[model samples]
Structures are given as structure tokens and as C-alpha cells.
Target: MSIYTIIDADTHVTETPDLWTSRAPAHMRDSVPRVITDSRGTHRWVLAGGRNLASAGMTATAGRGTFKNPPKTYEEMHPGAYDAKARLKYMDQMGIWAMVMYPNVGGFGAQQFLKLNDPELMLTCVQIYNDWQTEWASADSRRLIPITSIPFWDVAAAVTEVRRCAAIGHKGILFTGEPQYYGLPLLGDKHWSPLWEAAVELDLPISFHIGSGDMAEGLVKERVATYGKMAAFTELAVDIFLRNGLQLNDLLMSGVLARFPKIKFVSVESGIGWIPFVLEAMDYQFKGNSVAEEHPEFDRLPSEYFARNVYACYWFEQTAPRRLIDKIGVDNILFETDFPHPTSLYGDEVHARIKGGLSDCEESVRRKILWGNAQKLYKVTGPSADDEAKL
Candidate 1:
């Protein structure tokens, strides 16, 4: 077993070129998403009739020094981004121990499938992705945990997929923080009660990765023409990370967390430094607007629900690693590498970053943030990848 103890709360995979084709049923193989090169020498993911859901537009910028031009093909990405064993080896070299995996081809929350407008295809795509992920994680379940994707267009189907993936060992759910962006019912709507209920029962955390139909989508679209693609791209690179704050407010006030107190709502890849400002502001607005009186069932302050049921992850943030841990709450904070992503901690940078950024933190506090919190969140057990892989 690796002597280190760190469980990355959020990381992504660069789905192989044949990710869908290799797993898709014979009848549906041609219809599944796959990569194709355009006349401009850029590789992009497209569906059957070339319905454009762009990933090469920039999502694969892990090792690329410039965000403007990411890898045009899977051949360009760090092998660990797609290869499971390579990922484990990289983690061992970096001393990361374990990591919770997110997605790319499915648009982070499977929002890409909803765009197809074909229910059967959408659901099938989600199932295939989850099944593939489960099989992939079987490489090292204790270290590589997959968060299942769901067809958010159908809540009942989502509930069913949730249960199925849970049974198969997916540790959490990747959900869209703003489903209404796609004209679906809000998370607080009774229409979603089943999903919330199932998550609580199954004890699966609902992780809303940034850009999963969150405000960032709206912001980038509106700003592109005005700011120009170059400027918008640079701004969006960081702006999207903080846009999750929008969900934090809505969730705290919408009574979703209050009603489903046991459902651990995770704001993934969104740094935790903003938690104090936003949660405090949410509490201020809650009292100022008399929301407390209007909502008697919300028996606690907004920040209280955050401390009780919400989690926010952080990386490359010095202030949070230094002092915000107390304000953000120790247990509610989790460490993440966001590995192989443009903003990720790279290679041996992990040890130096932690030791330098969190130098003041006691070892116990650092341990809790690094792996202890994730162990409880993802049900990680025993020795990490190296040891678990041997079994």
C-alpha cells in the first residue's frame, strides 16, 4: 500500500475515442457518440447525425499549457486521463492514494444526452456509460470510485439508474445543479422528490460538478459575442468554477437540504474559499427577507444546513487550506486534485502544494481534509489503490 493518504474528491476522464462504440450494442454502435476529425484537423465528439455537443472546443486541457488549444484527440491526453492502470500509477507516484471520478463525454451531468431529444437513446447512453464506468472502476474499486450519470430528463428513470448504479458500486451521483436550465423541474420541485429520497435511502451523495447546467452555461453563452471568443474563453476558464455559488444560494433557501437533510449535496470542483462569503450572505438574506418566517419548516439558518448537509471541495487555494477550514467546517471540506484537468495539481506538485499551502494546518486537520472526509463521503475503505489493486 502507498504510505500516503489522500482521496481526491473530484477528477475527470478523457473518454477514449471508442468509449461508446466499444460498449454500445451492435444495433446502436453507429448511433453512439464518437470522435471524428474535421477538415480543420481538429478532433471533436459528435453524435449520429453530427449533432454538435463539443468537447474538443476545450474540455481536454489537462496537460496543455495553454487553455486555448487543448488536445484535439485522445492520443494527446495524458494516458491516465483514459487508462485506469495508468491513473493508478500516476496517483501512486503523486501519493494521491485514491480519487472520485467524474465525466466528460456525458457533459458532466449527462446533460449532453438530454440534448439528443431521444429518450431511448438518452437513457441507453446513460446506462452504457454507468456500466462502462462500473467495469472500469472494477480495476480498483477502493481507489477509483465512479459517480454514476443519470438521464435527468426522466426523474423516474434517474431514480432507477441511481438504485442500479448504487447496487453495482457507484459511490455517488453526478447531478445537474440547475436542471431548470434544460426546462426540467427545479431540484426543490416535488417532481424530483423521488431522486432526493432515493439518494437519501441509498446514502449516495449528489455531486453537482461545475458547468453541469449551472449558471456558467448561461454566462458563457451570453458573453461570447460581446467579450469575443478569446476573452470569453479566458474568463470562463475561471468564472465557471465560482458559478456554483448560484446553486449554493438556491439550495440553501429552496428548502431542498432542509427536507432531505440526509442527502449530502456536493458542490464539486468548486473551490471552498467562497463558502464563507456566500453562506454568510445566504443567512443574512434569509433573515432580512423574513424567509425564516415564510418557511417554518426550515428550522435552522441557511449556513446551518450547509454545515449539516453540504460539502464543497478545494484545490490550489492557499487561504482555504490555511484558515477557511474552520469557517467552511473541517468535515464539510474535502481535498481534490481535479487531476489531468487544466487547473489540476500535476505530477509531483501534490506533495509540495499540500505541504506548502497547508503548512500551518495540523496533521490531523490535513488528514481529515485529504482522505478522512472522502472515506466517509465515498465509503472508501481499507488500504488505498496500491494495496487494494493487489487483491
Candidate 2:
């Protein structure tokens, strides 16, 4: 079997109750999000309305058997859920040298923070969350990289938070790609300019990750609420694709990309199959006078800007990576293992999955998708071909 060192761009872990209560400042930690596991080992998030966001349906097991519910404690997931040494053991087993982690409950926490009405409270929560991620990544200096969440409702505060995350050693910022904050359109507002400018200046890529708890509804409705959380999770993967194209179109048409040429934008967990059609449409639209008149700064077409400034992360089973590399360019494609998700088992299974999908001719292309692209994106130094070959 041909071998390669994988860098999973999208592995995730849920937060346990003790995360904030034990690690955060006393007053804030007690009121922070708490985790609940059922007798069956099923896990869910318990928040203000007594709402429980279920995790993978099953709970934590004592060792390896399936739990009736998800594990109630973080320790059940790993020695320290964010500990680097524990993660490195798993990484070596899986042939992964590094991973970037997103928050469990913090996916929806940013939206809730926006609703709190006080910007101070919103900023504080974001600050604490970013700090937690920094500490978690620092636990294993070499293997884990953390991504920070943005409080979009407060643009200036959001810029401050992005810079803060960078200063504290975070790799990037995560946003939901929603324009409105509780029915208000912050899309065209000038307030977000600083946030965009900060990202450009700090050299941090802005990632639009799908599937926050309470998402904006008007854009796309790919699923219903009846089928439980899986419906939402499936729909989230679709929503990020739909809204990213919409938001990217807006940014390009509105001159955001032109204004911030150096800023890189990544659409994560959104499969790659849709790129050709989207790029084709934009290229066609720009050829006519329609797109040019809206923004004079756009000298090249939308596809050119996309190739220059944007990238898409392909999940393990997706068709996009193997199928669309030539169209999207190998440099713009990256690999991700949605670790601990229903689809991916967090072990050596990832190696088989990657090797199984890559064609012989595409081996070089696969290397870029699996590691090189991410190395460039995260600006982290990793093993060279000769060094990796020796493994």
C-alpha cells in the first residue's frame, strides 16, 4: 500500500461541562454550557431552554463498546479531550501528523452570544472560547491546531477577537456565513470592514463552517426538523455550500475580494462536486456587462479570483477531490476527516479511506490535497517528501 502523512483539516470534539466550569473564570464557567449523558450512553447539550443538542446518538463507553448515549465526560473521549500527546498517539496510528479542531457546542454558541444584546457579554464569551482553544492546542505543541469562532453581530469586537486568537496562537477564524443577525442584514454594513481588514492583515484565513445550532433560515431548506439532529447535520453540509457561493458572489460582486486581495477564504466541510458549475456560472456572468458594472475593480473574472483567493475542503468519501482537482487546481483542494462524526471512525481507518480513493495518476495530486495544501494554508512546517518517505 502506498503511504502518506495525513493532516486532517476538520476533526472535532464536543465540550464537556467541566471545560468552562473547571478551566474558565469562576463566575463564567459555572454558567457555561453543560453536557448531559443518558443512561443509554447517549450525549446531548443542555442549555437555557432545556434544549439538548444530541451528539452522535450514542453515549460514551467504558472502553470501546457503543454507549446508549454519548459519554458524559470529556475524559471518556480522551485523556484530555484536547491533549496533544493523546492525540499524537491516535495520529501516528492513523498516519496523521496534524489536525485542526473546531468546537463542539461553540458551533452554536457564537449565535447565542449575538442574541445576548450586550456586546461585552458577547465579546467575553468569544474571548474565553478562543482562550480555551489556544490552551487546548498548546497542550500538544506539534499536532493540534485550533480555530477560533467569531462574534459576527459585533464587527469591531469580531475583529478584536480574530486578532486576539492570532496573538494567542490560533490558526484561523470560523464563521457561519450568515449575513443577518436575528433578521438584521449586516451584509452591506461598513462595520464589517475592519474585521475583513484585520483578517487580511493578520494573514489568517476566514473559514465558513456549516451547521451551527440555530442557523439562518431564509437561504436554503435542504432538510426538516422532524428526523432529529442528523437531518440538521446533513443539511448543514449543504447549507455551507449554498451560502458560501451566495456570500462569495456577494463579496466578489460587492468588491470585498478586490478590497482585500490577500485574504484567503475557505469553504469547509462543503464537498467539492459543485465547484465547476458555480465557477462556470460566475465566469459566464462576468463575461457579460452585468457583473462588471456592479464592481469596476474586478478586472479578472470570478473564477480567477476564486482560484487566487479561495479553497474548498473535501470530506473523506466525497467525489470532489479525486474528480475536480484539474478544474479547481490541486493547490486549492484540501483533505479533511470529520473525525468522530458518524461517517469517520477516529483510527487507522482514515488511511485506508484515503488510499482507496486516490488513483495511481492522482497520487501526487492526493499528496497536495492531503497535506501540501493545508501546510501552505496553515503556514505550518511539516515533513518533507524525503522525510515522509522514510516513514
Candidate 3:
């Protein structure tokens, strides 16, 4: 039996070398993502047309003990990153009862599929990833919650994928934050209305992971060009964390929440401290700029939509709990480790880190952030009723 009740609200799995090629049809073996060792002996994934899929070694830092250089080959990284059974053991050791898992090869939002010129192949790639991920989570369905990616380029298909994955036990949807960048209609447009309706019907929360938006891609390019790669990553480690703030602002103002009152939106891997700041700005600007006059459909203050439908997660954040949990709202706040990825809360000291960061709050508040809330949000099930009592 487990000794703790911590549920990681967001985490990731490093896609195995043959994740796609093994699952794809014989025809798709060449076009789908596949690992290849180049002449220089460096391992990299390539798409059709031999386009090099650029990756940062930081994507899989588990068991390296330090977030240092890339591991060059799949053998150098930890099995927990790609193996379901291995991750369960790691979760047990870390005292995490459950985790919400996302994918790596597909981009946080599966945006990489957008680059595929063949629209049929692009949608099939999305389906393939989701199907494989579901099988991965089946290793332990109750504790390993799988989030599904959609063929967002086609909202009609996106709606179908959501329902199909939901029927097979996917708890939520991972989507790009800025659809406008993909040449699709924005989330607020009627074009995405069916997708939103499907999400509400399925009772699935929609998560927007950091850097899931094309806006983040644009930001990454501009910053790297200005500061150069090394300095931008080192000097602005917090930059990636902040991109979700823009997503939240757009979401709150988009009227989607108002239109679809039951849908929940999550800002995954984004910290809590900036949320109050963003909400404050949204409410202030809404009034100061007379924004309601421009969009009268917005029936309430922007901040009001947050606790009811918007959620944000935090890890390694000490100040937010001490100063702003109330402003951020306990129900809207979630806890995460972001394990096996860059700056994840892995290793022996992780328990102390979690304790130290959340120490000031009462146990009830802590329990909600750590376990209760996510369980309710993601519909996490059990080790059975009796066993759960001990937790």
C-alpha cells in the first residue's frame, strides 16, 4: 500500500524510439517519426523529406541526477521516461499515487504533426500517438491517467478524437493554446464550438501545457535570435513558464468559458504566482478599457471565470502558496512534479522539496492541492475504497 496521497497533476513520457514506426502501418514507416543514428553516431528523429526534428536534450533528464547535457542515445536515459512499468515504480518511490501523463514527440500539444504536408498522414499520426498512449496508460489505468492529443487542424475530427479517446479512458485533451497561429480559427470562433461542445459532453478538462501555443514558438525564435540559445535558456528559465499566462488571458477573454460553462481549462506546468497577477490585469483592463462594451457577451469579471473553470499547477514554487494561494484559489490550484523532464522534482530530496514548498498551508489545503482536487478533476479511481482510506 502507498503511504502518501500526492497526485502529480502533470508529467510526461519520453516517446520510445519505435513509438510510431512500430505502431504505424507498413506504409507509414518512412513518413512517420522514427529514430535514426546518423553518420556521426548521434541519435535523432526525422520526419518525411528527411527533415531533422530538432530537440533539446533537456526533454528527458530523469535519472541523470542532473539537468546537464543530452543523453545522445536512448540507452543513456532512464527507462522510467519511456516505460510504463518503470514509471510506476518511480512513482511509488516518489510517493506519488497518480500522474497525468503527456507526450514528447508530438510537441506538448502535438503541434509537430502540423508540419506534415500530408493531411491524411497528419491526422493518422495524431490517432496513432493517442492509441499508443492509451495502451501505455493501461499498464495501470487507475494511477496512470492518459491525456489525448487531437487532430486540431480539423475541428470536426478533433471532436471525434476527443469522444473516442474518452470512451477508452482518456481523462483530458491536450491542445495548442493559439490556434490562430496554425491558420485555424481561434478557440473563440464558432469553428471550434463543436470541439468545445464535445469536451463538455465528455466531461473532459482541456489542458494547455506551456509552449503549446504557436505564440511560444514565435517567442522562442525571437528570444533565441536576440540572446542566442545558451543564454536564452539559462538566463530566462522562467520564460517558458510564463507563456501560459498569455494563454490564460486569451482564454478568459475569449468567451468560451461563458459559452461553455461546464468546461474546465488547465494551464499545465505553469506556476500559481503569476495567475493572480494575470487575473488582476484582466479584470483591471476589462474595466479600464471598457472591454465589456466591445464584447458584451462577457457577463462576469474575468477573474470570476477562473476558480470555476480555470486551473493552474505548480512545482518548486515556494512563494505562491505562502502569498497567493487565496488569490489563486485553492480549487483552481494543482500540484505537480513534472518528473523525468527538465527541472523535474525527481531524486531523493523531492519529498523534502515538496514539503518545504507546501509547508505553510494547513493539511486540508495541502491535501486538496496534492490529491483531492486532481482526483476530482481527472476522475482518478482507486486502489479500492478500503485501501484509499489509509491514504
Scored by CA lDDT, what does every candidate get?
Answer: 0.83, 0.65, 0.83
- TM-scores vs. true structure, each candidate: 0.92, 0.83, 0.93
Number of clashing residue pairs, candidate 1: 0
lDDT of 1 by residue, 242-317 (tens): 7788888878877798888788999998898889999888888888998868889899998899999999898888
Q: What is the lDDT of candidate 1?
A: 0.83
Q: Which stretches of candidate 1 lie over 4 Å from their true place?
A: 55-59, 214-230, 384-391
Give the Å error, residue 127, model 3. 0.7
Per-residue error at 279 for model 1, in Å? 1.2
What stretches of model 2 exceed 4 Å from their correct place?
A: 1-4, 23-30, 37-43, 48-83, 115-118, 181-188, 212-241, 383-391
For model 1, what is the alpha-carbon lDDT of residue 272? 88
**Model 1: which residue pairs collide?**
none
Error of 2 at 172 (Å): 1.0
Candidate 3 lDDT, tens digit per residue, 188-287?
Answer: 8888899889889989999999877754444277787997876667655566678778878888888999899999999998788898888998889899
Error of 2 at 315 (Å): 1.8
After TM-score superposition, what is the CA distance of residue 263 in candidate 3 from its true location, in Å? 0.8
